[model samples]
Target: MQEMKAEIATKNSKKANLLDHNSLKHILDESVSEIVTSRGYAEDVRMSNVRLFIGTIIIVIALFAQFYKKKFPGNRDFLIGCIVLYIVFNVILQLISYTKEKNAIMFTYPPPGSVTSTGLVVSSKLPRFSDLYTLSIVSADPKSISAGKPVEFTKSVTQWFTKDGVLVEGLFWKDVGALIDDYAAVPKKKK
Candidate 1:
């Protein structure tokens, strides 16, 4: 009878162990899912911000151009040229943002190390402006590259700003990574 009782106790312990293992697995799976979803969301936010920033700059330029044209009606040709240039510049910018947005949407399940073609790097540390400029030099001048080309200048600038911002805020590397990720994952509406 004692031996039977021992056997039963061992079986119960084994069952408990199995349950614990399953529970632990479940918790781990949940944590992983949360992290992935959060990262994706952050990326989306960052992309959106990029779109907004670019859009805002284009709008500001357009407004300024309009102001200039109004202030100098005599140079109609120059004003028209400025307006055309602004429109072309913005259209190209929108196209780039659209492409990035499409890429982000297409990759619904990005692996942890999945390198984005857009050079979206999330860092918990912000580098200085000079550091950013150095990186930009290494990445090549984005401004020099045609607007239609897949350039890394914006990404370099973003990385630089992110590094600087994090340092100023005295945030941790992980927090900086999260911030950068958020910046890159900005929401973009359909063109």
Candidate 2:
């Protein structure tokens, strides 16, 4: 536990500065599509995880029904229903994932949870995933809405991921933060 805390503390200590709503908008406008693309990849991962979890639960329930058939009067019918439900659930999840993937390919106005009054309170933090680490950015403040929202962006920053991927070790945050800061510094052109 102490070791875990120490690791997390170290990661947090190395985090980049937060960019507010205007900064984020500037970055989005001027920067390449890589950030949006990364968001798509992250969404894909999130949806896959959801599918895996729910599928596992469904399978487990079906297995239980099979094993304890004598306990349930309509075991066969329940199993059939589970199979149908699983199929329907998967189809719906797939359609949703497809839509999100397609939408992510293009820039969208007023990101989810946008607010005129509060705007956005942005943050970038390194969150622990088991023994690995990921950088999570909350561009829109979930508190602005009654129901909270998930992180707006996330990317793996583990040693292997950093080594093999585009992000370099020790300078990952600097690279990403630079893009935002640089863009945010530029004056907007009059239309």
Candidate 3:
């Protein structure tokens, strides 16, 4: 009986040791995974910040070039070159901005209703024209409107047009409303 008790105690001790070791290993693994995940997120945020900072600097430089062109109108070639370079830089910056924003939206928001040949169309409880315009700008493709026929603008090439809040009125609000209505009417498939 004494020998049997000793054997049982020894077995229990070994079992306890193994359980403790497994528990410790599990804790360590969880901690390491958390640290790795946090580091990855931090790196992503840092990269985004760097991109935004660089874009801002480029835009500022572009604005300075515009100012210089205005200050020296006689140098037409230099002015034109600066303007072209500025536009190119601006387009690059906008592209980067759009990509980042799209990624964020995709990650945070629910999946869009359906992705057509053009782009994603989201269904909303309340649809507004301003919202549609903003969406069009974000989507960056005028061809995304897959619904009703848009009112054909039949103005001459020389016709001057401006936004409502601007110095001159351009396209009518009714036209914009129609465009939005058409966009909202686009068919969407279930996810």
**Model 2: per-residue lDDT, tens digit, 67-138?**
864555657677677778767767766776565332232322233443322222233333322322322233
RMSD of each: 21.8, 13.2, 24.4
Model 2: which ten-residue window has the lowest total lDDT? 160-169
lDDT against the true structure, per candidate, is 0.40, 0.42, 0.38
Candidate 3 — which pairs collide? none
Each candidate structure's TM-score, on Cα atoms with residue i matched to residue i, is 0.31, 0.34, 0.29
For model 3, how does the per-residue alpha-carbon lDDT over 32-151 read when each residue is reduced to its tens digit? 223323322111244357667777867776776667644575767776776777778778767876654442211111114634333322211112211111212123233555322322
Q: Given candidate 2, what's the lDDT at residue 160? A: 21
lDDT of 3 at 184: 38
Sliding window of 10 residues with minimal summed lDDT for model 1: 132-141
Q: Between candidates 1 and 2, which one is better according to lDDT?
A: 2
- Against the true structure, candidate 2 reaches a TM-score of 0.34
Prediction-by-prediction clash tally: 22, 0, 0
Q: What's the CA error at residue 37 for candidate 2, in Å?
A: 18
Cα deviation in Å at residue 175, candidate 2? 1.7
Order by lDDT, highest first: 2, 1, 3
Q: How many clashes show up in model 3?
A: 0
